[model samples]
Target: MKLFVDCKKAGHLCDKGQYEDASFFEKLSVRMHVMMCKQCAKYSERNAKLTKLLKDSKCKQMPEECKKRIREELARELAKKPE
Candidate 1:
């Protein structure tokens, strides 16, 4: 198994770890990368904070009809734009 990872892989692993989807090796790679890369460490920290804030917030889900309408509107707008 690879013991080291780049910043991009670290970011992806961090996201997967947050959702409990990363493997043990993937989590270890991310931890090692974050320990050495300050930027990635900060990125991981902010990602965790954002996840916590969103989880704690009492945000309601938008209705499916509303989401469909918004998507339709965006499609229409994009279709009207010149290539």
Candidate 2:
């Protein structure tokens, strides 16, 4: 595996790390990339902050049934409207 990753891959790895989903090598590569890239370092910092805030918030997801109902209602309403 490469010792370094690009900014895009680093960002992806950062997200995975946020959820504790990234493997050790992936995390290492991303960290190495961040160390070399100033922009990625900043991005990683913000991502970590966001992840911490989300975890602390104890937020819940809206049910899929409710989302489907909302979508169906919106579609019906849009269909009734004249363009």
Quick one: best TM-score, which candidate? 1
lDDT by residue (tens digit), candidate 1, 44-64:
999899889988999999999
Q: Candidate 2 at residue 54, lDDT?
A: 87
> For model 1, what is the error of residue 36's alpha carbon versus the real structure, in angstroms, after optimal superposition?
0.7
lDDT of 2 by residue, 1-83 (tens): 77788888889999999999999999999989988999999999999999889888967999999999999999999889586
Name the runs in model 1 displaced over 4 angstroms.
65-83
**Candidate lDDT (C-alpha), each:** 0.93, 0.92
Weakest 10 consecutive residues, lDDT, candidate 2? Answer: 1-10
* TM-score, structure 2 vs. true: 0.72
